[model samples]
Target: MNIAVLIKSVVATDESVTVSGGEIEDTEAKRVINPYDEYGLEEALRWKESFGGTVTVIGAGADRAAEALRTALAMGADEALLIRVDERSVDEHATAKLIASAISQRRFEVAWAGHMSVDNGAGQVAIRVAELLGWPHAGAVVACELTDDGKLLVTRDAEGDSEDWELTLPAMLTAQQGLNEPRYPALAGIMKAKRKPLTELTPELLGVDLAGEEASPRTERLGCETPPARPAGRKLAGTAKEQAAELLGLLRGEAQALKGRG
Candidate 1:
């Protein structure tokens, strides 16, 4: 089985996020693989180990994203494909179209990616790619493994419960966390990754026309505002009756908003 893992280069989760001029400033923030994408990569690596096939990690981002792709190679992907894009200027649909174009040229039995990106958290690329490929797709997958006969056994969270299904090959799956614990790259693996094949692909080569007519979402950012801070609570230095009355009043006032009766 040939596997392709989609990854996104995102700002480190620990960094404080700031938006300036309608764009996120992450010039100095550390970049890493999306946490859920790591789970997808680990799952792909496991499949490769069992089936004796190649695992390729692909990403769309600025040129500096090669570093994130290299990290995937260090984690045992056979190859890496970097699709550089100025993410700030592209919408998810265009990004997905580019990825789908690149994937169309690859010979793969399965594709994997995160359920959503931490930075943008759009959660649309995977599904759109699957649609473009006309393949079976499963999203928000919390657990995945290969069956004895090579089908995919997928478990997902749905409607407050977990569900499982077996899917045939040539499918796209969006991975969620808790699927499996990802292994850290050892020093030896990191050194060997330097010699691994890293393919840099352009949008043109991938048959993606950035300027061509395509379906993209219409969005307008009117303004940005911080949420109101919570009000300070008062300490009740009275009997339980006083506390009960205060609590009832608070509930009646705030909870009534839910029913539009405020």
Candidate 2:
């Protein structure tokens, strides 16, 4: 019943975003655990309480990522591991590689992660990790239960409806909202986190190479800027038929503008 939960450090939702050098400049923003991952972490902790086991939070990224692990430790994770990398140009594929390599060294009955990160919103890491590990994975999971025959049943959100999925041990689940309300780190928990076991790792130590990433990033960010302001609404100043004609003309103009761009 050893549980693995993947956590990530991200800029707080309320923080202002700044773009610099064709990338998000988040060095100065307050860092916190990604909100979506909190649901998965809470579910993992709940499962740990129901079935006796250790919950290990794993993360890979810049140095600030360790902070997210420590926060998870305070929230009742038994241990944590961080694969620290200095690169800023990492894409979902490269991150999946690093994380999957690290997870391969651990033994666990199940793994959990957020369906997507707030910043990236790719919703691809957990599925990719499951592929790398050769395990079945369910995304947008909202409910989980253990069957009598030693199987796990999970409810997945498909748009507005849900579908139940049964998985064997060593499966993966990406938690969606409504899974569970995560507990905050209390004063005592915060104190205990200082003594919890935490391991920091490197790519080379894990037999993964992240060097020369600038030459071949799976995804590229050419530039970042705010979208132009939206125009105000226009009121048609005419009778019913006249207004209809004006609206039709406006739509035709917009279509022609789109055609010109294409």
Best by lDDT: 2
| Candidate 1 lDDT over residue span 1-262, tens digit each | 8999998888898997666765566688888889999999999999888888899998887766788889999999989988877776577888888889889998999999998999779899999999999989988898888888878888997857899988888999988878889989989889999999988888888877777777343343454544568888767556899888777676678656335444
TM-score against truth, every candidate: 0.87, 0.90
lDDT of each: 0.85, 0.87
Worst 10 residues of 2 by lDDT: 253-262
Top TM-score hit: 2
lDDT of 2: 0.87
lDDT string for model 2 (53-172, tens) is 999999987678999999999999999999888647577777788788888998988999998999879998889889999999999999999887879899999999999999998898
